[model samples]
Target: MKLPIYLDYNATTPVDKQVLDCLLPFFSENFGNAASRSHLYGWTAQEAVETARQQVADLIGAETKEIVFTSGATESNNLIIKGLFESSFPLKRHIITAETEHKAVLDVCKHLEKLGAEVSYLKPDNVGNITLEQVQKATREDTFLITVMFANNEIGTIQPIQAIGAWAKEKNICFHTDATQALGKISVNVNEMNIDALSLSGHKLYAPKGVGALYLKKKSPATHLMAQMDGGKHERGFRSGTLNVAGIVGLGKACELARNSLLFENQKLSVLRDKLEQGILQNVSNTQVNGNPTNRLPNLTNISFGGVDGENLLMSFRDIAVSSGSACTSASVEPSYVLKSIGLSDELAYASIRFSLGKYTTEAEIDFTIKYVREVVEALR
Candidate 1:
C-alpha cells in the first residue's frame, strides 16, 4: 500500500490505466475535430465519439441518442436545471430539490431562484435520506422539475430515486438526478429509475476529468430543454461545443470497466468500508458514523469524532487523504451543511470526515487507516 492513502474517491478518482490507454491515441494520431464532416480524420473522430456515447449510454441503460456529453457533471447539472427553466420560464417555474444535494445542483437552484423561479429545498431526515412524502407534499401545479442527487457525497446515503421518479412520472413532471457519486458505486438504470434526465461525471468513476454525460430521455416530457450553449449545434443542439474525443474515449472505457466489475468491486469495498468504520468506532471514543447504516454507497463511510476539529483531524493524518465534506465546499470554515441537515450538532459537523473507498483501496490500507485514525482521535481528545 502507498504511504499517502487516498480515501476520497467521492471527490475524484484516478484515471484507470485501461481507460488511459484508450485515451492516449486520441490525443495525437487519431486526433480530429468531431464536428468536421468533410474529411477522413473528422469521420474517424465522429465515429469514435458516437461509439463513446453508446458506451456511456449503455452504462446507465439509456439509448445512445439520449446521451449528451458535457465538460463534467457540474455542466450537466447546469444544463438540466437552467436549460429546463429557460425552456419553460414563467410557466413551469417551480423546482424541487433536496438540501443534501451537491453544491453544483444547489448553486444552480439558487441561481434559478433569483430569476423568479420558486424552489423548494427538502431537508433530509436524521439518516440523511429524504422522504418521498416531503417531495409529494412540496409539488405544486407549477412544479415542472424535481432535481435530486442519487447519493449524498458526504454521507454516502442513497436516495429513493426510483420511487421519486415514479411519482414524478405520474405527475407528468421531469425528474433529474445528479448521479455523479452513485453511478459507478451503484447499479443505475435510467429506465428502471424512471429518470427523465441524469447527470454523471467521468472523474468520479475512474475516468479522466472534464468529461461527463447527461441522459435526456428522448420521448419524454423532459426532452424540451433549451440549448445552454450556442456554437455549432453539437450534442443534438442541446449543448454546443467540440467533443473531447480523448476524454470521451477515456470515459467510455471507464464506464465499460465499471459495468463489468461493479459487483465484485463493490463487495470488496463494502468489506473494507465496514472494517474501517467498525474499527474506528470501536477503538475511538466519542466517534459516530453519520448517515443511514444501510441503503448507502458500499464504498464509503462518514464519521464524526467528538471534541476534535475536522480540519485538525485531517491535518494529523497527513498520510490519509480524506475530506470534511464535498470537495467544492472544502475551503469553507463552516461545518458541513449536509451533516447538520441530518441532525448533527454544529460541533459534530465540524468534527466529521468523509472517507470514500474505491476499487483500488486495499485491506491493508483500511487496517492502517483504522489504527491511525483511532490514534489521532485518542491524542486529540
Candidate 2:
C-alpha cells in the first residue's frame, strides 16, 4: 500500500489512467488550434472538443450545444453568476444562495453585491441542508436567480436540488448549482432536477485540472448571460478563449467513465467510508460525525474530535492525507465555516477532519486509516 493514504478526494482527484491515455495525443500529435476553422489540425481539434462536449452533456442530461467549456468550476460559477447579473442588473438583481456554498459561488455573489445585486444568503440547518422551504421563503418578485451548491464540499451533505430547482422553474427564476463536489459522486440529471444552469470541475472527478463545463439549458426563453471573457467570441459567444483540448478530452473521458461506474463505485466507496467512520467513532472518545448522516456523498465522512487540536491532529497523521476543510480555504486559520454553520462549536470545528474516499480507495487503506486515526487521536488526548 502507499505510505500516505489519500483520503482527501474532495480537494482533487488523481487523473485516471484511462483519461490520461485519451488526452495524451492532443498534447502533441493531434495538437491544433480548435478555432482554426480552415485547416485539418483545427478540424481534428474541434471534433475532439465537440465529442467532449457531448460526453459532458450526457453526464448531466443537457443538450450538446448547452455545454460551455471553462477553466474550472470557479470560472463556470463566475460566468454564470456574473454573466446573469450583468445581463439583468437593475431590473431583476435579487439572487438566493446558501451560506455553506463554496467560495467560488459565495465570492462571485459578494462581488455582484457590490454592483447593485441583492443576494439572500440563506443559512443551512444543523445537518448542512438548505430546505426548499428556506428557499421559498427567501424568494421575492425580483429574484432572477437562485444559485446554490448541489452539495456541501466540506461536509459532503447533499441538498434538495430537485425540490429547489422545481420551485425556481415554477417561479420563472434561473437556477444554478455548483455541482463540482456532487457530480460523479451522485446522479445529476439537469432536466429531471429542473436545473437551468450547473457548474462542474474536471479535477473533482479524476480528470485533468483547469477544465470544466457549464450546462446552460436551452428552451424558448433561453438563459442569457453576458460574456465574461471577451476574445474571439468562442463557445457560442459566452466564453472566448483558446480551448484546452487535452484537458477537455481528459474531462470527457473521465465523465464517461464516471457515468459507467458511478453505481458500483458509490456502493464500494460507501462501504469503505462507513467502515472508516464507524471504526474511528467506536475507538476514539468524544468523536462526532458532521453533515447529514443519510443524505450526503457516498464516499465522505467529516468527524470532529472533542479534545484534539485540528492542526496538531493533521500534523501527526504522517501516513494519512486528509483535509481540515475545503482545499480552497485551507490557508486561512479560521475553522471551517461549513462546520460552524452546522452548529459545531469553535473547538469542535477546529478539530474536524474530512475523509473523502474515491474510486481508487481500497479496503486495506480504510483499515489502515481507521487504526492510524484511532492511535493519533488517543495519543493526542
Candidate 3:
C-alpha cells in the first residue's frame, strides 16, 4: 500500500477520466461565454451547455428548463430555501426541515428564522430516518416549504423523499430535497417522487468540483423564486451570471454516464462496502455499526470502535483515507449532529469511522483495506 486507498467518496469523488476527456476541448478551442450570441465559439459553448443540461435533467427525470446550474450544492440549497421565502405562497408561514439536514440547509433555515419565518426542525428516528408520521404532524397550513436531504452524506442513510414529497404535495407545500448524495448513486425521478425542487453537486458524481444545479418545478406557481444573484438574465433568471461552461459540460457528461450505469455501480460498490463492514465486525473487538444497515447507500459503512480515538485510527491508516464522524468544537468535541440526533453518545461518536466506496473501488482494494484496518485497530487496542 504505497498510496492511501481512497475511500471517501461521500466527501467527494474523483472526476471521471472520460468526463474530463469530454471537457478538455471546451477549455481551449471551445472556450466562450455560453450567454454570448454573436459568434461561433459562443454558439458552440451554448449548445454544449444545453446538451449538458439535458444530461443532468435525464439523470433525475427533470426537464432541461427545470435545471438551474449554480456554483455547487451549497448555493443550490441557499437558493431554494431563500427563494421559497421570497415567493408568493399562501402556505404555512412555517417551514419544516429535519435536524439532520446538511449544514447548508440548517444554516440557511437559521438565517431565514432571523428574517422572520417560523421553522420546525423535525427529529429523525434512531436510525437516521424521518418518518412520514413525523412529517405529517409537522406540516401546517402556512407551511410554505419542506426541505430534506435525499441521503445523509456522513451516515449514508437514504431518506424517503418520495413519501415526504407526496406528503408535501397533498398539502400544496413546496418540497425541496438536497439530493447531492442521491443524484448519481440511486434513481431520482422528480415527477414520480412528486418533488418540487432538488439540489445536486457535480463533484459528488465524478464530475469536477464547483458546479451544481437545482431542479425547479415548471409552471408551478407553487414556487415563485426571485433571482438570487443579480446579473445578465441567465439560468432562466432564477440564478444569474454566466455559466461555467467547462464545468457544467463536464458535470453533464458525468451525469449521463452515472445515469446509464447506476444499478451496476451501486451493486459493485455495495459488495465492497459489505466486505469492509463484515471484515471489521468479524475481526475487531467491541465495534458497533452506525446508521440503518439496510436503508443506507450501498457504498458506505460507518462503525464505532470502542476505546479507540478516531483521529488515532485515521492517523494509523495514514495509508488509508477515511473520516471521523465527530467534529472538533472550541470547548468540546461535538459528535456529528446527524449521529447525535440519531442518539450516539459522544464517546461512540468520537470513535466512529466512515468508509465510503466509489466508482473505481475493487475487491482487491477492499481486501487490502480490511487487512490493514484489522491490524491497525488491534494494534490500537
Candidate 4:
C-alpha cells in the first residue's frame, strides 16, 4: 500500500491510466490544431475533439452541440455568469445563489454586483442544504438566472437541484449548477433535472486538469450568452480559444469510464466511507459528523473533533491525506465559510476534517485512516 493514503479526492483526482492512454497520442503523433480545417492533421484533431465532445455530452445527457469546452469549471462558471449578465445587463440583472456556493460562483457574483447586478445569496439550513423555498423567496421579477452548486464540496451535501430547476423553469429563468464535485459521483441528467446550463471540471473526476465543459441547453428556453473570449469564436461562439486537444481527450475518456461504472463505484465508495466514518466516531471521543447524513455524496464524510486544534490535528497525520476545507480556500486562516454558514462555531469548524474517497480507495486504506485519526486526535487532546 502507498505510505500516505489519499483521502483528498475532493481536492482533485489523479488522471486515470485509461484516460492518460487515450490522450497521450494527441500530444505527439496526432498533434494538430483543432481549428485547422483544411489539413489532415487539423481534421484528425477536430475529429478527436468531436468524439470527446460526444463523450462529455453522453455523460450529462446533453446534445453534442450543447457542450462548450473551456479551461475548467472556473472558466465555465465565469462564461455562464458573465456572459449572461453581459448579454442582458440592466433589464435582467438579478441572480439568486446560495451562500455555500464555490468561490468560482460566489466571486463571479461579487464581481457582477459591482457592475449593477443584484444578487441574493441565500443561507443554507443546518445540514448544508439550501431549500427550494429559500430560492423562491430570493427570486425577483427581473431575476434572469438562479445559479447554485449541485453539491457542497466541503461538507458533501447534495442540494435540491431538481426542485430548484423546476421552480426556475416556471419563472422562465436560466438554472445553472456548478457540478464539478457531483458530476461523476452521481447521476446527472440535465433534461430530467430541468437544468438549463451546467459547469463541470475534468480534474475532479480522474481526468487531466485544464479541461472542462459547459452544457447550455439548446431549446426549451435556449440559453443566450455573450462570448467571454474574443478570438477565433470557438465552442459555438460561447467561448473562444485554441482547444487543449490532449486534455479534452482525457476528459472525454474519463467521462466515458465514469458513466459506465458510476453506480458500482459509488456503492463501493459508500461502504468504505461509512466504515471510516463509523470507525472514527466509535474510537474517538467528542467527534461529530457534518453534512446531511443520507443525502450526501457516497464517498465523503466531514467530521469535527472537539478539543483538538485543527492545524495540529492535520499536521499529525503523516501517513494520511485529508483536508479541512475547500482546496480553493485552504490558504485562509479563517474557518470554513461553508461550516460557518451551516452554524458550526469557529473552533468546531477549525477542527473539522473532510475525508473524501474515490474509485482507487480501498478497505485497507479506510482501516488505516480510522486508526491513524483516532490516535492523532487522542494525542492532541
lDDT of 2 by residue, 211-236 (tens): 99988999712368889999999999
**Which ten contiguous residues of candidate 4 have the minimum total lDDT?**
325-334
Worst 10 residues of 3 by lDDT: 84-93
- Which is superior by lDDT, 2 or 4? 4
lDDT, candidate 4, at 35: 96
lDDT of 1 at 152: 85
Q: 282-320 in candidate 4: lDDT tens per residue?
A: 999999999999899999999999999877877788899
> Per-residue lDDT for 65 in model 3?
93
What is candidate 4's CA lDDT for residue 333?
77
User: What does the lDDT read for residue 199 in candidate 4?
Assistant: 97
User: Cα lDDT of all candidates, in order?
Assistant: 0.90, 0.91, 0.88, 0.92
Please report how far candidate 1 places residue 191 from its true position, in Å.
0.7
Residue 285, model 2: lDDT of: 87
TM-score against native, each model:
0.98, 0.98, 0.97, 0.98
Residue pairs in candidate 3 whose N, alpha carbon or C atoms collide under 3 angstroms: 91-142, 92-142, 92-143, 93-142
Worst 10 residues of 1 by lDDT: 324-333
Q: What is the C-alpha RMSD of each candidate to the true structure, in Å?
A: 1.3, 1.4, 1.6, 1.3
TM-score of candidate 3 on Cα atoms, chains taken together = 0.97
